[model samples]
Target: MCTETALRRENGDRFCLSTAQAETLLTGAPWRRFLVIGDEVADGRGEPAEGYGHDGWADRVAASLRRIQPGLAYLNLGRKGRLAAEIRSRQLGRVLEFKPDLTALTCCGAELVRDPFDADSVEAEFDRVVAPLRDSGGDVLLVNWFDITRFSPRSSEETERLRIRLRELAERKQAVALRHGAIYVNLAEHPAAADRDVFGADGSAPTMRGHAIAAASVIQGLGAHLTGAGDACR
Candidate 1:
């Protein structure tokens, strides 16, 4: 069994879950095996960028879910600096092999920073990776890119353009997720995501604290979907 620790929210409220509550909440759910695929965020890239660490959001969520389902199997296939197309090409096949009951996809963050951004191509690749998982009867978590301008070191004009492109891509992704009944975790709309303190020195990968915020956001999105509170992201 896993333990719960206190995680602070943007409003300074603490989010904590008891073991019994976790078990109750996840009862009868089919999320025993969780798989994560995408870029640095899914890979658990921490500050200093030294190596993979257990401080990323995917790690945190896995730990929390273990309390509910002690037999939970979690696998993360996130690589630093991977574009959406690369994930679709390399990781999608491995993800299918895992046959995960729940999966989270967080790609395209690296692609948004590059020039000649092609929203159509990027989204199509994302769909290619996500559509199969959705069809497999597993719950998918689609995380949206936060507003890059908040931590971007680029010129104001460049950051603004990137932000616009990312937001557009996020919207399109959300639409697809909704169509497939996947839970969408909209970090762009989360208050904590805009806080520069939540990011690392590179202004891209998240710091330890930022990972906590992200994990909390994902859990909240899952709750919304499970409780029939409407679509997780709108």
Candidate 2:
């Protein structure tokens, strides 16, 4: 199911959108072009055994937006196993060329969870890509890294340490997003992130149902922004 709720900032301020406000945003001045860039999760990469049904969360968001504005242009630049820097190098230029009204950027998960994680480098690359899009007047949706430890069967010290590092990286990225006036979606705190059903065998990439949850989260985040709640980020 779609998880819709108010988002709280690190400073204790909360941002929310009422049902009527969300309805108004959906039906009023809807975005016409949607663009996505990131890794496998955003690419909707699942095991071949699972069989592909959905394209990914970005596509789901596009479908929902299309209902409000017909003939919406959609593009998905997500590639499996791509790191944040790689995404910035490959897809950033194309994103500018597309000039989308709305852009969803999901990066850094692949970098943060691996060995020799460099939080600063990842965040710098994120800003390099996102800053330009935001300057171009695109509504950027920045998705934070989720806690993959929740899906892990082991409870070792190493696992705990990795989780801590991931959280730190997420916080840094969220700060950058908010600083740039982007809509930040805190997937790490979402209840669905811990659900086994929401993930595939790899325990990282979201399943089809998981993508729906992600899509709903993005919509709710956008609704909050359109309704004036997200202005607090400024």
Best by TM-score: 1
Error of 1 at 230 (Å): 4.2
Residue 33 lDDT, candidate 2, scale 0-100: 87
lDDT of 1: 0.74
lDDT of candidate 1 over 84-120, digit per residue (tens): 8999899989999999989999878777878788888
Best by lDDT: 1
TM-score of each: 0.85, 0.83
Per-residue error for 171 in candidate 2, Å, reads: 0.5
How many pairs of residues in model 1 come into backbone collision? 0
CA lDDT of every candidate: 0.74, 0.71
Model 2 spans with C-alpha error above 4 angstroms: 1-25, 47-55, 230-232
